[model samples]
Target: MENALSTVSSTLLSFFNSQALIAAYDVEIFEAIGDGATSQEVFEHCNLPESTGHQLLVAMVAMGFVEYRGDIYTLKPDMAPCLLKNGTQYMGTLARHASKFLYPLWANSAQAIRTNSNQRKETFGDERKWFDILYSEPNDVADFHAFLSVLADPFVESFLKGFNFSPYKAFLDLGSGRAALPRAILAANPHLNVAVCDLPEAVDHMRQELMSSGHSDQVDVYIGDVISGDLPEITQDLVHMGWMLHDYSIKTQKCILANVFKALPSGATFIASETPLLDDETGPTFVALLSINMLISSDGGIESTTAQYLDRLCEAGFTNVRAVTLDGPRTLLIGEKP
Candidate 1:
């Protein structure tokens, strides 16, 4: 039994943590406090008023994101690498994306649930498809994809290390944001050919990025849309869609699976990586919350249970459909076209 007031206070005060972190990233305060700087030095570096700057730093300190001693403030040991703008593990892009996009959309979560539809119109006054509004501006596109790529880094490592890509000669990754997975696949299996399929809005930029990264000759790029049944010719024996299936409703997911099944050659392998609900429908808390976030922000997007995902794959005419576990956050739903 927890104290009711304590529980209520915890929920009520959660916004303070979010706002403090948002403010810290917005002003690039972590970048300003280089190698343990005093309050005055940080203020001067960030061009912030001393009084307001002091307040924000104190808030961050309370949030355990920074440490203050001897009148100097510094990022906590664990936070330094993950918070600073130029830090090796910087995740400010995710923080920025949350503040700029998700926060506003989540504000109407109740309304979204009541209506069972996205609140994009209410949040941004743009009723276009989620991706359309997301990619409407160049900066927004970069913000969305950049943060997702960063978030996918650990998953990419887990996937590359865990999955056996040796059996396939040609591989294609759908919705291959940043081409991280494809890059690693090519590196791990040099004999295999790798390509990426993405919407036209994303293909050119991803192609340029791959070229700049010196993978111009090794990786191919194709334009495709899985939802509308518009897909590139299938030459890949192993096709992967990473962390993408949960972004749509069950019907659309089935459509996507069917489209992939139709596009692949007989006996080709199809894999989709997703963070699914447990069989008991308990909580992997972040993924559960993300389902609600999807409900509020996307068009009929919601997370599914592993059983639910496997069922959809089977319904799509995939033979030998099954869920494979990796030592990572995402579970792989695999099937074969027979």
Candidate 2:
């Protein structure tokens, strides 16, 4: 009982850990220490007062993000890839997204739970749809998608390697942020025609990313919305929506699925990737937390069990519905047009 209470004690103070990391990112302390700088050098680099800097450094050491040697502090080697600005797997964008957007919304989680709705008005004084407010500014749009792209990198690699794409002649990715999946598909299966369908606001940014990534000539871009039925004439034999279904209420998810079903060619395959709750709804801890986060921050979004997802697919007139587990963060719920 005492041990359980101690765990509770630690859990309650966990926000301090998050805030410290955010503070480090905000002050450029992690980047300064990436090169194994001493406390004084880090303070100088970040323009932090020495005493506060030293205190934060000590806290970081205790948190295992930094290692304090006799004279120098260093980012823990394993964390450097994710924490350092120049690292290939940098997730500072996610940190920034959390700090700027999610954290404040989560502050009103209790209110969200009581009301069973998003807290956008409470947190940001905006009652707009989640993406409308989120994508209001260009920089906010970039940060939101950039962090998602980083998060999707593993899913892309795993999907490309695990899922068979050779049977399909053309592929369309709906709401494809950063175009990472379609880009990977193009690289691995060059013969398959690829395209991405997204909102008009995202088309320009996605086109730029595709162009810069050397896929402009190969991948097509389409402006469409799955919810409102403003869909492009999809000639693609396979359509994939990665990690998208959980962004809205169950009713909206069904609407999105039905619209996509109407857009696809006969005998086309459709896949929706998601991180869902377990069958018993016990825990895949992050996903459970994500469901709560969605409650507070999204448009009535909630995570589902794999069974719930497959049921939704079936309800949308999909045939041959099944689930595919990948070696990454998402599970692909697959169905086909009759």
Best prediction by lDDT: 2
lDDT, candidate 2, 1-338, per-residue tens: 99999899999988988988888888989988876999989999999999999999999899898998889898899989888877867777878889989999999989999999899999999988888887788777777788788888888989988898999899999999888888888989988999999987777779888888888988999999999999999999999998789999999999999999998889999999999899999989999999999899888899999999999999999999999999999999999999
- For every candidate in turn, the CA RMSD to the true structure comes to 1.4, 1.3
**What TM-score fits each model?**
0.96, 0.97
TM-score (C-alpha) between model 1 and the true structure: 0.96
Give the backbone clash total of model 2. 0
Model 2, C-alpha of 264: deviation from truth (Å) = 0.7
